[model samples]
Structures are given as C-alpha cells and as structure tokens.
Target: MLTQLALGVGILAVLVVSGATGPAEVSPLDAGRVILGHLLPGAPWTSDGSLTRLQDQAVWQFRLPRTLLAGLAGAGLALAGALMQAAVRNPLAEPYVLGVSAGAGLGAVAVITLGSAAVAGLPLSGAAFLGALAATAAVALLSRHHGMLAPTRMILTGVALGSLLSALTSYLTLTTEAQNVFSVLFFLLGSVSAASMDQLAIPAVALLAVTLFALARARALNALLAGDETATALGVPVHRLRGQLVVAASLLTGAVVAVSGGIGFVGLVVPHTARILVGADHRRMLPVTVLAGAFFLMAADLLARTVAAPTEIPLGIVTAVVGAPCFLWLIRRGRAARAGMLR
Candidate 1:
C-alpha cells in the first residue's frame, strides 16, 4: 500500500511537471492550476490571475494528452507483459511475444511508404491496428496443435512471424523515398508528440478492461505458474485461461502500438520490477505493476522531451537507455540470489 501510494504520488508529480515542460514557460504551479481549473467547475484556480490563457492552452491542450497517453501506454504494456509471462510461464516473455508490435509496425510502415491510396485508404493507426489483429489471429491459429493451444508452439510461431513481418517492414522502409525514411524510423522508434485526447480512448479502454480481467482471474494466473498439469488439477482451465490472457494482452499491445508506435521495455521491465518489489502473486503485483509502469513511462517521457531541450528524443530510445541497464542489473541480482540459495 505504501508502495502504491508512493507510485501514485510520483505519477501525479510527473504529470504536472511534464505539463509544465517544453519551450513555453508554463510553471508547474500554473500547470497544476490549469488541470484543477478544468476538472473543478467554478474553482478559485479557474479565476486566478496567475494562470494565463497561453499557460492553460499549453498545459491542457499541448502537453497533458501526450503525458496521459504515455501513462496509458505504459500501464497497458506492463499489464500485458505480466499476462504473457504468466501464460507462457516464461520470465522473459513480454507483450510483443505474440508479434503484435511487429505487425503494427508493418501496417504503419505500409501506409507511410506506399501511401494511403496503396493501402486502400487506411490511415497509419488503422492499418497498424488491423495488422496487429491479423498477427494475433495468425499466431492463434498456428500455435494450436489439434484443439489445444501450445505455449512453446505459440512462442516459436510468434517469433517466426515477427521476424518475417520485420523483414517486410524493412523492405518497405528501404525501397521508399529517402525523405519518408525519417518518418518511418520515427514511427518505429516511437513517440507521443502527436497525441490528442481523442487518441486516448482505445488504449485507456483496453487497459481498464484487461486490468479488470487480470484482477478477476488473479488466482487462476497464480495457479498457472505452477505448471499446466498443476493448474489443470487445481481447476484453473489452463488452456482457456492462457487463451484469454493472450487475447487480452494482444488487445492491449495493439491499442498501445497503434497510437504510440513501438515503445519497448515497459512491458518487459516494469512487470519484473513489480515482482521484485511485491513478489509474484498477481493479485498484489498487478496493481503495483500498473502504477509503476505509468510512473516509469511518464518519467521517461519527461526526460525524452527535456533531455535534448527543443529537440525531443524518441520515447523508445529513452526507455531502452534506462531499461536496458536496469534489466541487466535485475538479471545479475536474480542470478546472485539463486546462487546464494544453492550455496
């Protein structure tokens, strides 16, 4: 509970700070007032002279949406990662284990490289969403042996399909005009600079729905960690639960990637970090993972915009730079702990 409170407060602080950041000179207090003014009708802050129209516009219109989107994307990806890791019984599994991100990248790249007309007028986000769903369906079909979903087969098929899609995405990227390469690269690297309130709905809904599903099935997930046979003996319906988790995780990964592009590591890093803090029980770890993911991404997004000053770094780069080191450290720590237990 203390950890959750700290993370929640940290998210709030980062959100306000991110809103205040950028070329415009909106102070943090003014940013907070701007947020409060909008949320609270007839509040004193709404009439306060300290907040200017430009500040209000900058905070509410320009900054908050991207910040909120980052949080949503982070939370969604983290939850999906936890679900995937549990379903596959693999510590390294992430939301992209199902090839969803690769498919999204392929779809978005097709629209960007070939133009909307070539793709039958589908926009980048729409194409990406479709591609993600297509990838999920393909993996689902291929991973089944007879009537059963096989975890090993699922992982292998997803990896094979992801590599194929990535190759295609690369081919499209390379054959395109040199100028369009930058846009394609930027989309692949990921960013939320184009965010708007309207863009928030899909990921937000997916995250909420999946989080609820995960929480409700937390006990089943816990049982699955023991093994398929053990989970089945415990009355967990192993195959059905795993199938549901895959669908839920794919929904989350698709929703996030469609808007935010390919922000990596939130899924891979955040859930493991939550486990380190709160243990592996989904009931306890899920909420912490969601909050921690939101806080982590919001902070990373803040750094992405501010670290390079007027030139914003891509959000994916920031996450990789931070997450890689953290992940390595976690690996080292886990190994040392295991060695000690053996000793």
Candidate 2:
C-alpha cells in the first residue's frame, strides 16, 4: 500500500526527471522507450533503430542507478536522523548535526588522501564504512560516562568532531591535485552520480529491513518519547533497543554516504513533513518519513540533473537550497510554539 505508492512515485519522479534533463535525451516516445528499457532491461523501444550501447549505458549505467541511489540515500539518512533523535531525545540529532557524516567523510578522505593503497585499489565502500564506524565510535565514547550516551555531551562532541573532520577535508582539498580536489569536493557537495549495482544492494536491503523493524516496533520508540522511565515501565528494553537502532541506522547511513557523498537536510525535512501528514507517533511517523524522504530526494535529484541545464548541480546543493528555507520556517515555527503564538 504505502510501499507501492512510494515505489511508484519514486520511479515516476526519476523517469520524468530523466526525460526532462537527462544528459542525452530523445523524443517523448523515446523517453517512454528509455523507461521501458529500464523496466525490461533490453526492450526494443528505440525510434529509428535499436537502442545503442551508448544510449543503454547512458540510461542504465548513469541515470537509473543514480536515481535509485538518491532514493535509498535519502531514506537511509532520514531514518538515521529519526532514530538518532529518539535515542538522544533531541531535535538536532541528524547525521550532519551529530557529525556522523563528517566522521565518515573524514575517514574516507584520509584514505583518499593518504591511504592511496586502499583508495587506488579497493572501492570507496570499505573506506566509507570504516570512517562512519570510526565517527560513531568517537561520538559514543565522548558521550558515555560509565556506559550511557549523554544527550548534551554527545551533541557537543559530535559538533567538535565534525568541525575537525571538515577542517581536515578542507586542508586536504587545498594540498591535493585540482582534479582530486574536485572529486573530494563533490563528496562535500553531496551527489548521486557514483551509483552502481554492486554498491546499491547493501544500503537498500539494510534500509528496508530497518524500516520494517522500526515500523513493527514503533511502540517502543514512541514509549521512549514518553521518557526513559516510562518506556522502561512499558517493557521497552531501552539500552538494547537504542544500541540496535543506532548501529543499524549508522551502518545504513555509512553505506549511503560511501556511494552518494554528503546529501543534507532530507533527514530533517522529511520527518517534519511526515509529522504534518501523520501526527508525531513514531509508529506512523517512521514509515511516512521513509516514503516521504525517498520522494523528496527523487524530486531534488531531478532538479540536480536538470535545473542548471548542462551543468548538473549536486543533490546536496538542491537539498540545501530548498531545505534552508524549510529550516528557517521550522525555527520560526518553534519560536511561535514557545511564545504560545500557535497551537
């Protein structure tokens, strides 16, 4: 039901965007052919002749995987944000806000800049996963006193670590080759251009599995919102659940970042949008956020591909441009809520 709609909207949005601004487009009929070729792998839908390998590669290799990557990336980031917010009981606990993405970026950047053996030989996947894991470890360590994550301490630690990582990434950019800098900068800008099937499976399956688990046990999450003591009273295994969610979501985010760079704000915006559609209940909110996040990124990725014509924008830039205003609006709304200016 919700799943099908999400899939339909995601696919349709990409198809429309591909037709409008894909790097070498054809006629309306050919657009249909492009989509059909994707749906059927090797369908004969060309106008004058058979679809060329160039065309096939253009549509299949570059565009389609990129689109799929965007949706999964968006969904994974959003879910991570949601879970983090619950785990820490904070509004500003996103991957970027808490420095997980930065940690991952710094780790991968270190490999790219210094660990040439791995960067030149192995795929970025392993580097990225290690980086994210490293960052998560730093956050957990800094926040834990005896054996628990302190919310304020965790956020401060994350911010500090994130700033440090960003500085290193910038320093590397300054010292490295121009082309290498551009490649590194793309990760900072956040993009979906590097997608491939070999890379896509991990995040997609992890996100799908986590989302299902989250949905099925949303009550536990919701109970956490009622405060830790209340959740415990209600039979929610607070520490174990938190551990499960954080590790699961972090792995998912790391997988996405390994491929998609550093897309921002989908996590922040999508959950807010979900709250509008279905109240603030995590059970309902989780699924809605997942679906909404995918849709938002698909639309944003379309803009990334088409809005500037030949000069494709990074998906992160579009999300920031659009999400900044939404962030401001949310901040203002929060002020209004505090002032008793709105219900």
Candidate 3:
C-alpha cells in the first residue's frame, strides 16, 4: 500500500515535471499554481499576472494536456499489455507486438491519406478502433489451437500481420502528397505533443472503466496463470475470460492508439516491472502496473521533449531506447534463472 502510494506520488511528480520542463520551461511551482488555479475553485494561486499570458498558455493550454495525455496513454497501454501478457501467457506480449497498434496505425494512415470521406464518414479514431479489433480477431483466430490460444503462434501471427499492415501504411504514405508524409511518419512513430483536452476524454474514461473491470476479475487472471486446465478446474471459464480480456485490451489499446499514435513499450515493460516490485499476484500487480506505467511514460515524455531541447524526439524512439535494453535483460535473467534451477 505504501509502495502504491509512493508510485502515485511519483507519477504526479513526473507529470508536474513534464508539464514544467518543456521548451518554454515553466517552473514546477508555477505549473502547480496554474493547474490548481484552474482546477481548484477559490484557490489562492490563481494564475495571477505574475506569469505572462504566453507562459500561462504554454503551461495550462498545452503542456498540461500533453502531460496528462502521456500519463493516460501510458497507463492504458500498460494495463492492456499486462492483460495481453496474462491472456496469452507470454511475458513479451504487447499491443504493438500483437498488431493491434499497427492495425490502428493503418486505419489512421488510410484516413489521413485517403481522407475520412473515403471511409463512409466514420471518424478517424473510430476507424482505427475497428482496425485494431479486426487485427486482434485475426491474430486470435490464427493462434488458436484445439480450442485454446497458443502464445507462440499468437506472437508470430501478430508480427507477420503487423509487418503486412506496416507495408500497407507505407504504400498509402508513398501515394499521398509529399507534404502529408511527415505527419504520417510522426503518427506512425507516435507523439503526444498535439494533445488537447478534447482528446483526453475518451482515453481517460476508458482507462478507468477497464481498470475497474480488470480489478474485479483479478482472481480469474491469477487462476489463468496456472494454465487453462487448472483455470477451468477453478471455475474461471478460461475461454470466456480470455475473450473478455482480449476485448478489454483491444478497446484500451485502440482508444490510446487512436489519439497517441502507437506509442510502444509501456505495455510490454511496465507490467514486468510491476511484477518484479509486487510479485506475480494480479491483485497486487495490476495497480502497481498502472501507476508505474503512468510514471514511466511521463518520465519518457519529459526526456523526449527536453533531451533534444527545441527539437522534440519522437515518443516511440525514446521508449524503444529504454525498453529494448530492459527487454533483453529480462530474457537473459530468465535464461540464467532456468539454468540455475536445472543445476
């Protein structure tokens, strides 16, 4: 409980730091004042003329939403990743690895290049969500063996399908006007810079609802970890539980990917980090994963913006640099542990 509280505090600290340390460099104190001024009625620190309008705009209108979006995206992705890993029973499973993000990317790319009018008047995000669901369904179908989902096949299928979707996205980009290519690339790489209060709504609500649902089913998740037969024996309804997890994970991934454009690694790494901190118990791990994920992404976004100064790095690149090494270490650690057990 103390650790969870500490993580929550750390996430808030990171959010503040992210909001403050951007290009314009609003001080954390001023950032707090600006936020509190708006959020807390009759608060003493109400954006008095001590800060210029431009500074206020930078902090409140831009950085705050971006930072909040980063947290929400990270938390949602992390929760989705945790659920995916548990459902597939693979430590490495994640939204991107499973083609959900790539599928979402393809939908967003099509909308951007071919125009929304081409997609029967559906909104871009809605198209992206449908694409994500379709990709997940395809992977599930391909990976199922004898009435159960096979982790290895699921991972392989996702990789193959993700590659195919990427190719389609590339083809769409190449055929579009040259001016449209950069935005396409940016979306593919992912960024939260253009985040807005409006964009924050759906993801925030989705995260809350999904987190609550997952928590309610925490015991079922724990049972599944022991294998399908064991889970079935425990009355966990393995197939139904897995299906529900897939749908929940897909919805969460689609909502974030639609807005944030496929930021990777949080879902893959954060859950593992949570397990390391709190052990493998879902009840304990899930909450920690959510907090750790929010903290990780906020910190990543902070580095993404400030590391390059005026030129912001892509969110995906930053996450990859951090996640790749951690993933490799995890693999090595697993190998070493197995060897020790054999010895």
Candidate 4:
C-alpha cells in the first residue's frame, strides 16, 4: 500500500513537472492551477487575472496533452513488452525487438506515402494495426518447429523479419516526395511534439483493455512461466493463452505506434525494471511495470524537448541514449549475479 501511494504520488509529481516544462516559462504552481481550473468550474484560477492566457494555453493546450500521451505510450509499450516476454518465454522479446513495431511502421508509412485509398481505405491507425498483426502472424508461422513455437527461433525470426520490413519501409520513404520525407523520418524515429487531446483516446483505451486482460489472466501467465508442458499439465491452455497474448501485445504496440511513432526500448526495458523492483509474480509486477513505464517515458520526453532547448531531439534517440546504458548495466549485473549463484 505504501509502495502504491509512493508510485501514485511520483506519477502525479512527474505530470505536474512535465506540464510546467517547455519553451514557455510557466511555473509549476500556475500549471497546476490551470489544470485544476479546467477540471473545476468554480476554481478562482479560471477568472484570476494572475493566470495569463499564454500560461493557460501553454499548460492546458500543449504541454499537458504531450505529457499525458507520453505516459500512455510508455505504459502501453511496457505492458506490451511484458505480454510478449511472457508469450515467448524470452526476456529479450518486445514490440521493437520482435518486429511488431516494424510491421506497424510499414503500415503507417505506406499510408503516408501511398495515401489511404492505396491501402484499402484504412486510416493511419487502422493500417498500422493491420500491419502489426501481419508481422506477428508471420513471426509465429516462421518460428514454429514441428508444430510448436520455439523461443530461440521466434527471436531470430522476429529480428530477421523486422530488418526486412524496415528495409521495405525505408525504400518507400526514400521514394516519397521531399516534403513528406521529414514526416516519415520523424514518425520512424518517434516524437510527441504535435500531440493533442484528441490523439489520446486510442492508446488510452488500448492500454486499459490490455491491462485488465493481463491482470485477469495473471495466474495463467504465472503458470506458463514454468514452461509449456508444465503449464499444460496444470490445466492452462497454453496455445490459446499465447494467441491472446500476441494479439493483445500487437494491439497495444500498434495503437501507441500509431500515435507516438516507433519509440523503442520502453517495451524492452520497463518490464524488466518492474520485475527487478518487485518479484516475478505477474499480479504485483504488472501494475509496477505500467507505472514505471509511464514515469520513464514522461521523463524521457521531458528530456528530449528540453535537453537542447529550441531544437527538440527525437524521442527515440533520447530513449536509446538513456536506455542503452541502463540495459548494459542490467546485463552486467545479471551476469555477475548468475556467477555468484554458481559458487
């Protein structure tokens, strides 16, 4: 309970800080007042001349939406990573590592380059979702050995397919007009600078639905971790559960990628961080993973915009810079721990 309280407070604090940050120099107190004023009709801040229109616009219109979207994207990607890791029984599996994001990227890029009519009239988000499912299906089929999905095979196949799909996406991007090139590149690398309140619905809904599903099936996920045969013997429907997890993860990856572009590492890093903080039990770990992911991305997005003021770095670049070092440290720590256990 204390831990939950701390996490909740931490998330709120990050949100307020992020909302207050940016080119405009809005103080944290004014930002909070603006947010509260919007939520509460009778708040004195709404009518108070102390709060300027510029401050309100900066906090309510721009920063808040971007911050909230970052949080949603982080939570969604982290949850998806958790699902993929469980499904594949591999620690390295994630939306980006597993080619799911690549697939979604291809779909979205195609729509951008070729237009919606060329891609069956599906909107950007819909196209990305389909592309993710297609990529997932391809990986699953290719990774099967003697009618069973092999963990090593899945990882290798996902990497290969992801590279191939990325190449195709690049080809399409290169062929597009010069004006579209920047949009394509930014989308591929990831950003949330243009975020709006309207853009928040899809990811928010997807994350909520997937989180609920994961929590409900936490027991089955726990059993599956023991191995397929063990899970099967214990009455967990391994095949069905794997399918559900894949679809759930794909949906989440597609949803967030559609909005925030292909921001990597959150899915890969956050779940592991959660497991380290709490034990490997899904029930406890899932909530922590979601909260941690939200905090991680919000912080990353804040750094991305502010690190080089007046010129924003892409969100993906920031995540990679921060996440790579942390990931390497995790690897070394894991190796050292294993060596100690061997003694």
Candidate 5:
C-alpha cells in the first residue's frame, strides 16, 4: 500500500517534471500553471501570461504529448511484461521474448526501406502492428503441444523466431539506400520525440483495455505462479488463460511499438522491480509495476531529451544502459538467494 502510494506520487512528480523539461526548460511551477491554464481555459492560473506563446505551444503541443506517450508506452510495456512473465512462469519473459519487437522491426524496416507502396501504402505503424501479430501467431503455433500451451516450448520458440525476424530486419537495413540507414537505425533504436496527439489514441485505448482485463483476471495470473497442474486444479483454465494473456500482451506491445519503436528494458526489468517492491502477488504487484514503468520511462525520456540537449539520444539506448546492469544484478541476486536456500 505504502509502496503503491509512493510509486503513484513518483509517477505524478516525474510526469510534471517531464512536461516542464526540454531544451527550452520550463520550471515545474510554471509548467503546472500552464497545465492548469489549459485545463481551466481562461482561468487565472497564469494571470500574468508570462508563459509566452512559444512556451505555451512547447508545453501543450510538443512536451505534453511526448511525456504522455512515454508514460503510456512504459505502462503498457510493463504490464505486458508482467503478463508474459506470469503466463510463461519465467522471470526473463518479456514482450520481446514473444518475437513481437523483432517482427515489428521487420515491418517498420520494410516500410522504411522498400517504400509504403509495397504494403498497400500502409503507414509504418500499421505495418509494424501486422508484423507484430504475425510474429505472435508464429510463436503461438510453434509453442503449442497437444492443444496445451507449454511455457518452456513457448520461450524456446519465441527466441528462435525472434532471431529469425531480427536477421530479416538486418537484411532489409543492409539492402536499403545508405543515406536512409540513419533514419532506419534511429527508428530501430526508438524515440518518443516524434510523438503526436494522433498517435496516442490507439496505445492509450489498448493500455486501458489490457490493464482492466489483467486486473479482472489477476487471480488467474496468480494461479500461474503455482505451476500448470496447480493452476488447472484451481479451475484456472490454464491453457485458455495463457492464450488470452499472450494475445493481450501482444496487442499492447504492437500498439506501443507502432508509435514509440522498440523501447527496451521497461518491460524486461520494471516487472521484476515491482515484484521486489510489492511481492509476487499479481493483484498487488501489477498496479505498482504499471506506475513504476510509467515513472521510469517518463524520466528516461526526459533524460534522453535533456542529456544531449538538442541532439537527443535514442530512448532504447538510455533504457539498455540502465537495464543491462540491472539484469546482471538480478541474475547474481537470484543465484545468491538460491544458494542460501540450499545452505
């Protein structure tokens, strides 16, 4: 409870900071006033109008969307990661584990390299969504055994498929014009700076739907922690639940990846952090994970923008730098704990 409250407050604070922050750099108080002014419309929140037209545009148009998108992307990916971890009963499971990122990358690269005409003039995001769904379907088909979803098989299959998709994406990248390589690579690395209000709709809807569904089925996810046989014994419908979770996770991943590209580590690491802070109970941990992921990504995006100023770093690079060390630490900690238990 305390943890949730703390996480919630942290998320709000980071969002406020993120909204105010950028190359221009608005103070937190001024940012809040800008937000209130917009919300209230003709209110006295900014009586002096010291924010200026450019500042107001920066806050409302560019910074706000980017911040909100970062929050949504983080929350969606984290929830999806938590779902995958629970469904597969594996600590390392993530949206990327199911080949979604690789597949989406392939789709995005196709549009970038081959031109939109190749895919019925589909936008990058649409193509990427299709690619994500395709990868998920392949993983599902390969992982199923005698009408049951096997966690071990799914993980192995996802890895193999993800590798293949990644290879194909690389091939496309190599074949494209040399000049366009940078743009393709940048998208591959991920950034929310390109965010627009229009891009927010789909991801926002998907996140809300998935969060609600996951909350409602929190017990089933918890049952998964106890293993397939135990979950089945509890009338948890293990196979069906696993299927639903996979699809939901895939949908959330596709929507976010469509707009934000392949921002990493939030899905892979945030859930574990949540578990550590709030324990393994999905009902308790899920919400915390969502909030933590949102806060982490918003802060990360802020850093990506301000760290290099006008140059801007890839969001994925920032996450990987942070996540890689955390992952190693997790491995070391897990092994130490297991050894302690044996002793």
Candidate 6:
C-alpha cells in the first residue's frame, strides 16, 4: 500500500516537474509553479502584472481553478465508475459505458448549434448536465420497470442510446460550421484547458463533499460485493443502497461532465486501476480510487498539453488510448482469476 502510494506520488511529481521545468511552449510547468505557490506575491502571467501578482492572478485566478476543475472531474468520474461497477457488479460499467457521455455530448451540441450567442460562459456545461441527467434518468427508468437491472438488457439499452447521441453529435458538428470545428471537437473530446476558477469552485466543493459522504458509506458498498441476497442477509438494503449510490454517482458525474465537456474513459480506467492496487475492499479501494483518479487525470492532462505542444490534445484522447488496452486486460484477467478460483 505504501509502495503504491509512493508510486502514485512519483507519477504526480514527474508530471508536476514536467509542467514546471520543461519548455514554455510544451510544458505548463511555469503555470503549475505559480499555481502551487512557487512564485512570490508580486509575480503573475507576465512581468508587467508583477511576477507575484501575475502568478497570483494567473495561477490563483486562472490556471489553478481550471486544473482543479479537471482534477475534480477526474475524481468524480472515476468515483462514479467505481460506484457503477459496484452497483451492477460489472467491470465494464461506467458513465460512458451507459451512454451518459453520448447524451451529454448531444446536449452540448444543441447549445453550440443554437444558443452560441444567447448563452455564453456556461451554456455548454448546462447543456451537458441536462443531457447527462436525461440519459441517467432514461436508464434508471428502464432498469426499474421489472424491479431488477439485468446486466445484458442495461448494456444493450445504453449502447442504443449512446449510438443515438453520437449520431446527433455528429450531425450537429457537420452542419454547424467550418470555423467552429475546433470548438465542437474540443467539447466532444473534452478539454479542461479553458477552465476558469469561478467556474470550477462550486462543483469542486460539491464533489468533495459528496466524495466524503461516499467514503462514509464505504462499508455499505463493501457489503454489496457479496451478491444482493447475501448482502441483504448481512443487513445492507440492496435496493435502497442501489438508488442512493446511483444518485450520488449521478450528482458527481453531472457536476464533472458539465465542467469538463464529454471526457471519457477516466472513470472506466481509474477505478479498475484502484481496485487492482488496493483490492476490492471499499475501505481501501474507495480512497485509493479517488487519489489514483486525481493523479491519473492530472498526468493525462499534463500529457495533453506537452505531447502535441501548442495544439494540445484532449484529455479524453489520452485516456482512451491508454485505457482501452488496460481495460481489456483487466476483464480477461478477472475472468481467468475467477476461473482459477472456481477450479
């Protein structure tokens, strides 16, 4: 455990240093340094703003808030992934796995396509939240029809819904504009580069509070791993707990999705990685997942900036590229492990 924590710390340090000491064009290290209090009070974005003052305004007022938002998004999404997996007892369950991303993607596209001038500052987040909520609600309603969530049925519904949303997103992007391609692409792929502190503060606080609440409920979640009937015998209210977790996951996910655009795969990858490191015991698993999510997202964001320089790749792309293989391996290994155990 100490070793894993140390390794996580090492990864974070490497990313931080890369951001701080690397070339200005590729690395956001100077930005991170300012954000982390490396520069004095009079410094900031440029010398004229005063290095401290500039750093203060740049880091505190600008960069810190945005990066922090990205962190929150990562933690929230990863945590949501953890919850979804536990709730359904499926390794493949996540916000995106259920088509929430696609739904959110559709909502943002609606705003971008129609309300670009009428709604600014938060139109995208608003749209995305509504979309995500709508998707979650749809799935919830469908799952409750028979008072049971059959995994295959839920998966199929999500896939269908996600396809519809993806088609809508594509249609909007194509018909909208040649000039607006970059903006739409950024939103679709998810970018925290455009975040502002004022925009991030509310959700950051909300997610943290909810995460603490989840930690408080960790024992209950642990009970859930033992199958619903067994869990009920052990005094866990399976249905009620399921509803509570869904709401919590949705709250965290909606908040993060609103801010980060439709970032995908972090949730799927981070919690699985967390489980691998800390085991399935929610007491250790939950906290490790949260921290792991934070570090993983932060590192990914750093790479998003440095990997392609000024052009900047989206964090979602980085996660998908890295996560897909890891996820495949995870499922394969889980099946193998279960097989061995049965034998």
Write one digit per residue (lDDT tens) for candidate 4, span 1-343: 4555677787789889987897788888888998999999888768969888999999999999999999999999999999999998888889988899999999989999999987899988788888988998999899888887777888899999999999999999999998888888888888899999999998999999999999999999999888899999999989878878988998889889988999988998888877766667899989998988888888899999888988888899999999879867865677423422112
- Write down the worst ten-residue block by lDDT for model 4: 334-343
What TM-score, to 2 decimals, does candidate 2 have?
A: 0.87
Superposed model 4: Cα runs more than 4 Å off? 1-3, 144-150, 330-343
lDDT of 1 at 303: 94
TM for every model, in the order presented, reads 0.96, 0.87, 0.91, 0.92, 0.94, 0.83
- Candidate 5 deviant stretches above 4 angstroms: 326-343
Q: With candidate 3 superimposed using the best TM-score fit, by how many Å does residue 152's alpha carbon deviate from the native?
A: 4.5
CA shift of 324, model 2, Å: 2.4
For candidate 2, the per-residue lDDT at 129 reads: 73
Tens digits of per-residue lDDT, candidate 5, 1-343, equal 8988887888778767877787676888877778788889887756676787777778888988898899999999999999998889887799888788888888998999999987789999999898899999999999989987889999999999999999998999998899879878877888888888888999999999999999999998888887888989999988899999999999999999989998878888888877766677789989998888888898889889888887899999998886778756865676423422112
For each candidate in turn, give its C-alpha RMSD to the true structure in angstroms. 2.2, 3.5, 2.8, 2.5, 2.4, 4.2
Per-model CA lDDT versus the true structure: 0.88, 0.75, 0.86, 0.88, 0.86, 0.73
In TM-score terms, candidate 6 sits at 0.83
- Per-residue C-alpha lDDT of model 2 across residues 1-343, encoded as one tens digit per residue: 4643765666675665565356575554555576676677545465446666666667767776777778888889888888887777777678887787887787677666666475545556677777788888888888776687677787889899889888977897788766677777778778887777677898888898888878877888889877788999999988778777777778878888888888888766666656655667787778777877777787788888677877878888899898778756855765434422135
Residue 135, candidate 6: Cα error in Å is: 1.0
Measured by TM-score, the strongest candidate is: 1
Q: Tell me which of candidates 1 and 2 scores higher on TM-score.
A: 1
Q: Model 3 lDDT vs. the true structure? A: 0.86
Model 6 misplacement above 4 A: 1-4, 7-15, 18-58, 116-122, 147-152, 325-343
Rank order (by lDDT, best first): 1, 4, 5, 3, 2, 6
Q: On a 0 to 100 scale, what is the lDDT of residue 178 in model 6?
A: 80
Better of 2 and 3 by TM-score: 3
> In candidate 3, what are the lDDT values of residues 307-332, reduced to their tens digit?
88889888999998977797567656
Among residues 3 or more apart in sequence or in different chains, the pairs in candidate 3 whose N, CA or C atoms overlap within 3 Å are: none
